[model samples]
Target: MYDLPSEFPEEPGLPDEFHDLQPQLLSRTLRLTAYSQENWFTGTDLNVYYDPTHVLWHKRPDWFLALNVPRLYNGDDLRMSYVVWQEQQPPHVIVEFLSPKTEREDLGRFYRAQDRVIDPRADQFPPPLAPVNTPPSKVEVYEQYLGVKHYIVYSRYTRRLRYFQLVSGRFQEQTLQAENPRIWLADLDIGLGIWQGNFEGVPSAWLRWCDRAGNWFLTDTEAAQQRAERLAERLRSLGIDPDDID
Candidate 1:
């Protein structure tokens, strides 16, 4: 007698650890973009086609941002995936939330600043990736190929943030800050931060926290709602109807 084979579940696109908090990172990224005045786009499943030979296919960043792009291109979706050659724009900022497998690549230690740009003038701002006299590495070459400006890696294991800025065509490490902390996107004039809040009935770390509470903090939307609720309650207490405010 012939027997049918038992069905097995399809394998996940990423490993268990990467899948866990990836959604949280994407959600925060979208929320931060919405908080900004300019429009921003993000995707989790899209493939970034970097190499024209179709040999190199990089999956989505945990989050990425490009400023001054139109909401839509040619009446089609802004992008199916970011094609550097086709789109002619590199991501202004890219962030990777650390997973065990990809942490090393995200924070490439061998990347040095002197390797990225050509010395047309011979006297430019210091290269971004390395101090003077320091030779660049494979990571530096990879970044030069990608044309990335700011690359960030946040460690869930350590709960720390590391930042690299592309200055003079090479990336330079900068001290990550939290005191009056803000992620200043000069192109958009916006910032990103963590906000403890509820989402889908669960407390989560949201990306935008625009107000201070009594030793607590609230997001811009949350704070607005609180203000509205308080004003309504005050009107009720004074026997003045909120509906009267037209």
Candidate 2:
């Protein structure tokens, strides 16, 4: 059902500066959020639809999030793509990596203008200005319109971060506390920040590795596995062994 246009130019692959690190950053951030919250979903590079037209579309953020949904689809697997029209909900947050090509769209004005010219099938898509009691804040509108909350724009070029939150039908920029390098999202009770560390002897900003003390970096699934193993070992040490029960 989801197909790219033949006339649509080939998706320019992510530039060398962004190809690897950006994905890793997005993945780790999503993992951090999902691990810390319940009934919340986080994804990277999943399809997302905001307008009813489904005609105007964008493919996944560096990372995106939806709150109050099953962490797993059907209780097992993560979602591959989010069709806002199909899903009927907006993501609570979105993160956009700054690249020369897409900084404008992520900032809101670009997509808004593009959406204006889209000639949406009104029947298929709701009127842009249809009044709703709780019209999202400008930032929230990005979630409502783009199905993303807490729009995050990060500049690899500058290593700087900017975050916006939806409030009372408008967007407001949030400033970070000097003590905390992470951006705080009160909605999710979590924070996102760059971590400088070593992984497999390669210095990388977003690495998923564990230390001897059983503390871990950003390996989501791996962290779960480690937790399970720790529990099993603890049970055995207490003589409440699974083998004995069997």
Q: Which candidate gets the maximum lDDT versus the true structure?
A: 2
Question: Candidate 1 residues 1-246, lDDT tens each?
Answer: 012112213312243443444444444434343444334455444455555654343445656665445545433554556665665665667776654435545567733342222324436433233335433332453377676777766554444556677787788877646653345445444455554556446565544423222132343455688999999999999999998999
Candidate 2: segments with Cα more than 4 A from true spot: 1-9, 12-21, 24-40, 54-56, 71-80, 108-144, 178-180, 199-202, 206-246
Task: State how far residue 163 of model 2 sits from its true place (Å).
Answer: 0.9
lDDT of each: 0.52, 0.55
Model 2 C-alpha lDDT per residue in residues 1-246, reported as the tens digit of each score = 144232223443243545455555455535433344557676665555555544445454666667666677655765656656655557777777655445545566424332222222425533233334533333334745663457777665555567777666556777865442466665555566655665335565542223333233455655687897898899988988755664
Error of 2 at 96 (Å): 0.9
Pairs in clash, predicted candidate 2: 136-169, 137-169, 137-170, 138-170, 138-171, 139-171, 143-147, 143-148
Query: Candidate 1 regions off by >4 Å?
Result: 1-39, 110-142, 178-182, 196-200, 204-224, 227-231, 237-246
The TM-score leader among the candidates is 1
